[model samples]
Target: MATLMAVMVFGGAAALALYALAATVLPQASRIAAVLRGQSGNVRFEPLSSLVRAERRIAVRRWAAGSTMTAAALRPREAA
Candidate 1:
């Protein structure tokens, strides 16, 4: 029972310390990180069109490859 209480106290202190550190650090960290993101004065949040285009291209390529593989597998093995 005493051990359990000790563990709970230690865990709570550790959590609070971690939370305080993160709270102190995150704002400065994010500001520095955002600079690397190269945000212009105007930041627009929108879905990227290029992502959708690339996804479609990948899907088409996969479908073509799958069809070719299936056709090749369906062919009878040549007798030796």
Candidate 2:
């Protein structure tokens, strides 16, 4: 009975994970693969220099316990 219960719990979790991936990533990944392919149908790999870039780094001691994020909002010209 324990083995059966464990299997049911993990299986449901795995199904939900796969569903999330299929919903979010699969469409964008297909477009990226198509863009990277060459005329001969092979994937033309790019060098790391082109793929990765350095961003402005912030020095942080530690992360806070919770996440609170902000988004850039648009207003009328006079608001700025």
Candidate 3:
């Protein structure tokens, strides 16, 4: 029973250590992959930019409709 308990504790510690290492490394690995792909012109920015713009438009519309947290009052007026 004591041997079994020691083995379980050691396995759990090893698993936790592996998880911590992966959490630190995976994001940096993904970013490096993105940069490498971008260098080959495979990364597209327009879709992301358009999505951001659309989200902003939605937020502005929501604000104009009197949703206080969306900052509708901060939207600039369009000139006639």
Candidate 4:
């Protein structure tokens, strides 16, 4: 019973220490440790839709390269 209690207490303390380190120390450490020179004043990221579209194009190109059948052959026939 005593050993179990000691283990639980120590485990909890260790967890708290780790959480404190991540929550408080990590962000400041990154900001302080790195020195940056400004190259661009504005930073713009590509929209999610555009990124997904680019990835889809890449996948289609890969599929086309690997497959023996042409894309037109893979399409379903039109109903009469």
For all predicted structures, in order, the TM-scores are 0.38, 0.41, 0.38, 0.37
Per-residue error at 36 for model 2, in Å?
3.2
lDDT (10s digit) by residue, model 1, range 1-80: 99999999999999999999999988778566777898554455656877898999999998888876866687899899
Candidate 2's residue-wise lDDT over 1-80, tens digit each? 99999999999999999999888988677666766783344456667645343221121212231233334333335645
Q: Which has the higher TM-score value, candidate number 2 or candidate number 3? A: 2
Taken over the whole model, the C-alpha lDDT of each candidate is 0.84, 0.62, 0.82, 0.80
lDDT of 3 at 34: 71
Instruction: For candidate 3, write residues 1-80 as lDDT tens digits.
Output: 99999999999999999999999989778667877787543455588899999999998897777755456657788999
Per-residue lDDT of model 4, residues 1-80, tens digit only: 99999999999999999998889977766454543443344444669979899999999998987788878878899899
Clash number by candidate, in order: 0, 0, 0, 0
| Evaluation by TM-score, superior candidate among 1 and 2 | 2
Top candidate on TM-score is 2
